[model samples]
Target chain A: MIQIKEVVKTYPARDGGSVVTALDGVTLTINRGDIFGIVGYSGAGKSTLLRLINGLEMPTKGEVIVDGKEISRLKERELRQARQKIGMIFQHFHLLWSRTVRENVAFPLEVAGLPKEQIRKRVDQLLERVGLAERADAYPSQLSGGQKQRVGIARALANEPDILLCDEATSALDPETTASILQLLKEIHREMGITLVLITHEMSVVRQICNKMAVMENGRVVETGMVSSIFSQPQQALTKQFVKELQPSTQGDDTSGEVVELPLGDADKLVALAKEHGIRFSVVSGAIAGEQDDCLRVRVDGTEAQMQAVRQVLCGGERAC
Target chain B: MLTGIDWNQVSVALGETLYMVSISTLFTALLGIPLGVMLTVSDRGYFWENMWVQRTLGTIVNIFRAVPFIVLVLFLFPVAEFLVGTTLGPTAATVPLIAGAAPFYARMVETALREIDRGVIEAAQAMGASRLNIIWKVLLPEAMPAIVSGLTVTCVSLISFSAMAGIVGGGGLGDAAFRYGFQSFNDGMLYICGLLLVVMVQLIQMVGDWLVRRLDKR
Candidate 1:
């Protein structure tokens, strides 16, 4: 569990210029067992928010509470102890090039002062879990980007932390690698039940695995809600833009037409009935509306008389038209 | 050409050169590594992040490095006399040798440490590693190859500094060349000493490069 309360972070300019505000009066709560995704473009304060969760950067004016402890006020020594329970993975993977995979994974365990025997056992298990057991002896330079991220994941999970913060964890990979990494993250959340707070500019990443989501712009949270609701009914302009980008494109054609929503099972029936009546119809988009709720959305194009006939069947032949 | 060269004296001089280089290099590494690590960590945004310490140490290293080695040896004559109880032999020469070379080597160490990726250090910190752990486990190991190369360069300089110590009656091949080759006009002895110094430098460089290549995993 994490709570960010009215947090404001400012950094003095390097050239003795005016201060820059990275986060302004931001509040967010990530519940336990949540794969919470924070989506925003660069400079949207997404990374600053993730860093505050683990006390990597202190807020200038507000409190960051994680697991009920105020991270903003903790001393350096106390923060070090607290950080062991909050693992972070980076877009660059941030692995120590001098160390092999096994040693890299054992790093957190060594920092936690685990015994040598215990560390060895734990690292082996972690390597196996991330499917990097065979490459345990390889340096980061020898592995591909995907393998390097697997090592990062193993190293992050070494301490068995209660939360994992991913700062664009898959942003550096190709699309295929990104999908595989995202699937691995989903598996990690399902099996470990660890809370995940991921920040990325990619809306598709959030839609793939995140259960809850937030949209950020210019150092503030513009929108936040369940992923399903935000996808179906985006409230803000930026949120709508993100949701629209995910829609099946109309091939650069004008989208002005009659939009209809029906259950997934009834989609084929409507298409057949429209075909029999000589009405032009096309399926616009389809998505899982909610948990166990599948819906099909389509766009129908025809004359006013033709539209009336389609609505008549749905209105029970009343011809209220 | 070899007739005028005294083989016994040349051997003794060669031994003295080795003695001076080995002792000074040991002390230089011992002093320089910690100074370099301190200079690196005390820098702004590093683990220690102390502006005063970084600036002060940096200034001292620069001051020592800026002085010419011959002049540094002359200036440290009193120190050598006080520490080694004499200013006339290979042992006494090391006092100034380390003083000159440690700061030179420290600067190299700083550069090597600076080359490390900042993200690696941040990763270590995020894992809750203590400051000591970060320095020992992350910074030092990551910069090892460059550090070794730096030491090699420092050791070669130390060999040349030992030759300069001969100007002050600090005994070595340089003293032998000065006494027999320049003063007594024995050109053969001068060539032999010069040739031997070149050989020593080449050997040190070869070893240094090999070690760096071996240590560099990236």
Candidate 2:
């Protein structure tokens, strides 16, 4: 549904008279109905990329094709028209605070010049969908962070947009709220088949809903592919680092005796080895260095004989085991 | 028994002061609002985003703002004479009052517009709202409370300016106070006019605060 071709975005430093390349000749494609995630830290240009897709910002170079239209080349009128099919939510849940939730949701429809009755009906339905029906009369200030985000979601989906762009939609939310919001997003995707493009520094967000994902670093898409493949076997070093960050760790514990690095395929053998030696071992963390194979960093605790047995099984006779 | 006090003259002066302030305020709102909107939209990264246009318009507003209101009233005498055919009464007083106050109000409008979160504007743009629609629907409504409060401040300034308008042959309470009270050495007249001005300012502030609170759901 979206094709970003060699897009580059540069912003001039507001004070220093220097140019900052926000997106440096990056390219990626997002299929329709796919929940695609662009993961990056601050200043990685993921948000900039999202803006380009919706024509909020034109690319300094190359084209952003959304639903077969080159958004970068579109005139203001055409771009605005194109944008009606592309809805967006923000980290801050940028609802017009002066407006009630229902009115805020109705804004896009109003902009579309939908009839008043129709606008009201549609807003009511959207509020129902986002579970904010009772808060229709409440202004944004009265809503909690999650509720505000729900209103943001309702407003974005008001025009029945084909694409929903979430710019850190749940970043400001607490963990529990983030999970609920992610679940809501998944439900929306499942029901409507609307393409979702979310960018965040949070890997757990991508892991939760994204089917396809991209890893952005220093304004470049260093890696991109199916989420499962990327999680199981990350090709780039940065991707491996991100994947590693999500793995459960037993670091900083004073109890564990030995830490072992074993291939993912050796998990069974390691268990059997631990059993033979009467050692207790747990998969503490793991990292998939694509070329080096997926490895589990396990913590093992037991007497010296048990440690010796584990070392013998894994390392064979290569060392002191 | 009270001596040389003329209640009719006091009432007339009050009426003229009200006339000058109200009329000038209306024009200032009409003119200053658009100027302020223009300044905001043309700002860098905003909808219009024209550096030259933004800077030129900004400089103009600044120049007008920098000129002291009294000097501006005097400076605008010729234009006032050309527009109203006389630089001597309430009608003439409105010319300098608007000229002096509009730019100041425009700056206030710009400030109010600036206070709106850029993220809100970005969200509007992302929804495919046209520049005009963003201004009319998003910018104006979101900034309404601040704009109303700013307008209140502008009205208070205009009231003060109208008093100065007395110096330019613009007859109002200030004129009556100056002639019958200061020049004629009538302390009572000055005190009454001063009290009325204070009451008027207080009334404007109270009304403005109420309106702002009413408008601000944020």
Candidate 3:
């Protein structure tokens, strides 16, 4: 488990003016055995927050507690000892090109000053776990990108770390590779019972594996909730922007040029208009994208009562009809 | 024509040259790598210091690198004498050779280290590695090829500098040439010593190139 309390990090500019604040009063807690997702755009200080948890960068203010120890205040030796409990993976793979995959995976154990034979056994077990046992002898340059990331995964897990922090772990990967890596991360989380914390701008990555989620903007947590709940009902504007992009329905404006009558409170208008003229509506994506009286047209005439029931069940605001 | 030259003296000069060059190269490398790491660590823009220390170091290294090796030999005779109690033998002569060669090699090492990706450093740290671990494992191993190439350059440069050790009776191949070939203007001796110097330089270059290639091969 990790606890962050009011952490702030600022770096002075070379021009000697106002400083750049990377993290400002960020407080969050990550429980054990949970894949916590932190989503934000570029420059949202997501990477900085992740670095603080791993003890790679100390916070300028407050404390970061990991495994019940205050990591932010730890000395070099103590911090290193504490960091052995935390593993991390990066988007760039970070495999040592000069070393074989086995050596890369073995580096952390070697750095821990473990016995050489133990390191060898651990690396073999890790490489086998990541399904890269056959590629153990191969150098990073000799392997494909996905295989290289597999090696990185094996290396991160070699220490048997209690927590794994992934910083944009799949952003550099292709879609299928990203999917496999995400699945592998999920499996690793479940199988090892390690706490997983990943930060990314990709909503799809969150959709696949995250249980608890936090959306960050301008170095602040704007919204936090469950994955399915956030997908079905997002609170913040940024959350809506991300969730709408994931929706299967909702194309371009349906009623801007082509109108639809969902046969609701517009029943009288539909009859009066039907007497004068017949209106033909085409269905696309089983939902429409249009607005009347500040109410967005979410569905059309396919299911009339369900729309009202959805509206009645979800009475959001005064804008809802 | 060179058949008349003293073969015994030539062999001695060749041996002494080998002694002087290798010793100086080894000494400078020992002194240089630490200095190079310090230079990178203490670089003003990278570290917290002002530009004065960096500028001062740059000035000193450049001053040494810019001075001709023969002048350096003459310049450091007093310091060499103070350090070695006598400046006449190969051991004494090696003082200035190392002094002159270290900054050059240190600069090369600094360049090699500076070229390593900072991302590798961050990744190493993220793995719970200490700064020393990153330096030994990530920085040194990743920069090995460049460091090998730098050593090659330093070896060849030190070999070239060995010719200037003839001053103060330093007694390498340059002494043989000065005593018999260049100063006395013995065409036969001159041709043999000159030919020998050329051969020596060529051999140094070949070994250096081979070592670099061998070490650089992944």
Candidate 4:
């Protein structure tokens, strides 16, 4: 479990006359055994937040409490000890190219001062878990991108960390490779019950694996909630844009009607209400005739007054509509 | 031409050259590597980031590196005399040789260490490796191939420095050439010493290249 409390991180600008705030009063709590995904555009402070969790970068202000220890205030020696329980993977895999796969996996174990024989056994088991046992003798350069990530995963797990922070672990891979890597991460989480904190720019990555999600913009968490609820009912403008991008569009060129999305069970009630109000409505996509879908998207043809009325009812006085 | 050359003296000079180069190179590697690692780690944003240490070491290495080997040897005559009790043989010449070549090799080692990916070092840090462990296990191992290549270049330069050492009565092939060849006008001794120096350089380069090839995985 990790709790980031009102953290603010700032770096002195290159000019040395001013500062750039990377994270502005951001607060987040990631529960144990969670696949928590932080999504943002570049420079949105997601990576900064991830680094804070492991004490890799200390906060300019506020506390980072991981497993009940205040990481930001710890000494370097104590921080190193704390870091052994928190493993991280990077976008580039960050593998030691000079070392063989087996040796690379043995690195953390060696750092932890495990015996040579025990390290060998642990590395063997980890390689087997990641399915990279056959390529143990190869250097990082000899492996493909996906295989390199598998090695990264095995190395991260070598210390048996309770929390695994993935900083765009799949961003460098092809889509198929990304899928396989995500699947691998999912399996690792299930088997180990380790807490996973993943920061990525790819919304689909969060959707595929994360149970909880946070949307960040300009060093602030604009939205954070369960993934399912956020997808169904996005609160902020940025969250709405992210969700809209994932929707399957049906009215491609026809910009003539007002499109509204609601739960599938409410579609009939909305249709009867539209008939009572003498408004014409048609199901544009999602859930066509006896097939159940999570969301029911409908296009309504009406005047400005009718459209406003329909929006008022659907939004239930919320500003998102 | 071959009959005019003193084969016994030429063999002795070759042995002296080998002794000077081998001894100076050993000391150079031992001193230069730690100096180079210090220069790298004490740099800005590195694990041991200390501005004072980095700048002080940088200035020292630069001062030693900027001086020509011949001038450095002459300047260090007292030091060689004090350290070796004489400034007249292959053994005494190593004082100036290491002083000149160690800084030169340290700079090269710094460059080799810099060529490594910073992310790899950061990855080691994230794994909770101690700073000493990171230096020995990660930085040194990762930069080894380039370091070995740099040492090879340093060794070749040390060979030439030892020849300069010979010019000042530090007995080696250069002394033989100057005494028996140039002064006596034998010409055969001069040609033979030149050929031996060339052969030594070639052998060093071949071994260096082979080691680099064997070590580099990237």
Candidate 5:
């Protein structure tokens, strides 16, 4: 559904000078109906890649092809028309604060100049799909972060887009919310056969929904393959760095004596592996099994919204005021 | 009570004041907003990138913006007279009001329009909204509250400028007070006019604040 070939983008420095290259010859193809994932840390050109797919930022060089159309060559009029078929959600959710949930969802439809009845029908379908039917009348400021993302999800789906591009879509959500959203995307993809693309620093994002994964570092795709392959045996060092969590220590490793610094990415995998091996793995050093260990070292899930809820609950809801 | 203070005359003068200020405010908003949107569309990187177009439009806007209202009134008398077929009446006076302050109002509107989140613009563009639809549906709607507030501010500014119109022989409350208060030495009438202007400002401010809040309920 989406094709990017040798795309390059450069932004000039703040002080009249040389340019900073954001994307350096990124060649990627996301098959239709695939939940494709691009994983990277900050400044890995993930966002730049996302914008190119949506045709928001034209490639400084090369071509971005969506469906049969070359989006980079499409004019503004054609681009907006093209974008209607490709829905996107942001990390921040990007809900218009002035508008209520329903209105925010209605914006794209309104922009597309869709008829009122069709727009309403689509919006209702989307809101129901995102499980935000109850909060349609509420403003974004009144909704929780997860709820806002849900609304954004509904909005993104309003156009019945053939491609859904989520740029850290779940990053601002809690774990529970992220899982729900991931499940929602999976459901939508399953039912409608629409292609979904998500980029994040969180590994679980790929684990849960993405069937295809690409590992990016320094604006280049180091590895791209099936999700199970990348998780089981990552070829690139960076990919391995991301997938280290699922690996088990060789059968005779001495974890019974004391806590050891295991090279695991997330706590869930650590626990699962330890239980599977029937070994007593103590996390005593660094952030191995402490409070911080609970967080994904890779942040592939990109759902950052849980931290606030955790804080609110831990602080007895008083700090939320 | 001052011996010669005519309360009835004060009321009529207030009526005239209301008439003059209302007309000027209407013209400013009517003419200014479209001008501002034009400025936004005409600039480089948007539409028609001709440097001469940008320069000519910028110079026209700046010429009006930089001139004082008092000078613009005097400068525009011929044009105002030609437009309205009268050089010295409330109706004729509006031409100068729109000409003198429309650019300033447009500039304020342009700033307000620009302050809208660029994300909204991108989102609109991504959705296949035409340039006109982007303006009418997204940019204009998003900037509505600010534009309304800007209009209120422009109204208040127009009320102040109306006082300068009195110099062009368009007799309104300002002229009444100037003749009856400053020149005729009617201090009580001057005070009354000052108080009325204050009340008018408060009314405009109250309505403006309420409108901005209503439009941006969040």
Candidate 6:
């Protein structure tokens, strides 16, 4: 379980005068056993939020409580002990290239002061769980990117951490590999009942595994809710933009000249125009690039009368119509 | 040409060179590596992130590295004599030799450490590794190959620096060449000393390269 209360993080500019706010007055709570997703574009402070939870970076204001203890207030030694229960994986995999896969996984156990034999057995079990038993002896550089991330996952899980923080864990991975890693994470959460908090820019990632989600923009939480509700009835403009991305493209044409924008709930209007006027129409494009309006482009193929009716509907009896 | 030289004296000179270079290299590695690690970890946005400490140590290393070895030997002569009770011979030369080369090697160590990805250090922290564990287990091992290569360069540099110590009665092949060849006009002795120095540097490079290749699994 984790609770963040009005947390703020700021960094002094390298030029030595101004301060840049990385996260501003953000408050959120994650329940135990919940796989929560924090979705944001780059520089939205999602990664910074993850670090606060792990006690790697302290917040400039407010508190980050994990497992009912304030992590920000903990001293270095105590914070390290607390971090033993909070594991993390990274976008870059971060495997020690000089170390073999097994050694990489075993490193935490060794650091925890486990017996050598116990560490070996646990490492073997972890390697087996991640399906890296065969590659245990191989160095990280010899493995593919996906395999490297798998090693990261195994290494993070070695200590049986109560919470797993994934900072863009799947962003560097291909779609298929992302799916498998997501599935593996889901399975781990289910079996171990560990809390999973993943920060990502990928909408599909949260849709695939996260039940609860927070949408962040400009270092603030724009919206937060169940993934299904957010996908269906997104409230904020930024939230709607994210939801729009998940919509499958309705465009069915090989060639098109122009595109028109549509707000949500306009598919019926296009369908009616086509049915009443006997016009052949298809939704061409889903959303345009860097535009506020979430739109759908439609291609019309019809007679002059039908075209005129469609134009009237589109223009709403305005000057163009 | 061979008959003009004393074989015993030539061997002694080679031995003295080896003794000075090897001993100074050991001291340099012992002192330089920790200083370098400190410099890297204390840098801004690094693990320690102490601006004043990083700047101070960096400035000190730069000051030492900028000084020429010949001048450094003379400049440190009083301190070397005070520490070792004499400013002459190979033993006394190691004092300035280490003082001169340690900062240079520390800079190399800093560069080697800088080559490591910061993400790896963060990952180690996230895994509950203490700062000591991260430094020892993660940073050092990850940068081992680069550090090894850097040490090779440092050792070869030390060989040349040790020869410079000969200007102040620091006995080595340089002193032998200065006394026997350059001073006495025995060009053969000078050539032999140059050949031996070159061979010493070559041996250091070969071993260093082999060690680096062995450690670099990536």
TM-score of chain A of each: 0.80, 0.78, 0.78, 0.79, 0.76, 0.78
Docking class of 6: medium
Q: Chain B, TM-score, each prediction?
A: 0.97, 0.96, 0.87, 0.98, 0.91, 0.97
**Off by more than 4 A, model 6:** A250-321, B1-3
If both were scored by lDDT, which would come out higher, candidate 2 or candidate 3?
A: 2
Better of 4 and 5 by lDDT: 4
Better of 3 and 6 by TM-score: 6
lDDT of 1 by residue, A151-175 (tens): 9999999999999999999999999
Give the CA lDDT, 0 to 100, for residue A138 in model 1.
91
Candidate 1, superposed: residue stretches over 4 Å from native: A248-321
Per-residue lDDT tens digits for candidate 3, residues A12-68, read 776767888888888988888778899988898899999999787789998999998
* TM-score for each model: 0.88, 0.86, 0.83, 0.88, 0.81, 0.86
- Residue A44 CA displacement from its true place in model 1, Å: 1.4
* Per-residue accuracy of model 5 over B42-70 as CA lDDT, tens digit each: 67555323667667777899998898888
User: Which CAPRI tier for candidate 4?
Assistant: medium
Misplaced by over 4 Å in model 2 are: A13-17, A250-321, B1-3
The 10 consecutive residues of candidate 2 chain A with the worst lDDT sum are A284-293
Give the lDDT of residue A275 in candidate 1. Answer: 79
Better of 3 and 4 by lDDT: 4
Error of 3 at B175 (Å): 3.0
**Segments of candidate 3 deviating more than 4 angstroms:** A247-321, B1-3, B43-63, B66-68
Q: Each candidate: what lDDT?
A: 0.88, 0.87, 0.77, 0.89, 0.75, 0.85
> lDDT tens digits, residues A147-248, model 6?
998999999999999999999999998999999999999899988999999999999999898877999988889899656446645689988788778766
The interface root mean square deviation of candidate 4 comes to 0.7
Candidate 2 docking quality: incorrect, acceptable, medium or high: medium
The deviation in Å at residue A261 for candidate 3 is 29
The TM-score of candidate 3's chain A against the true chain A comes to 0.78
Of candidates 4 and 1, the better by lDDT: 4
Instruction: Sort by TM-score, best first.
Output: 4, 1, 2, 6, 3, 5
lDDT, candidate 4, A118-192, per-residue tens: 999999999999999999999999999999999999999888899999999999999999999999999999899
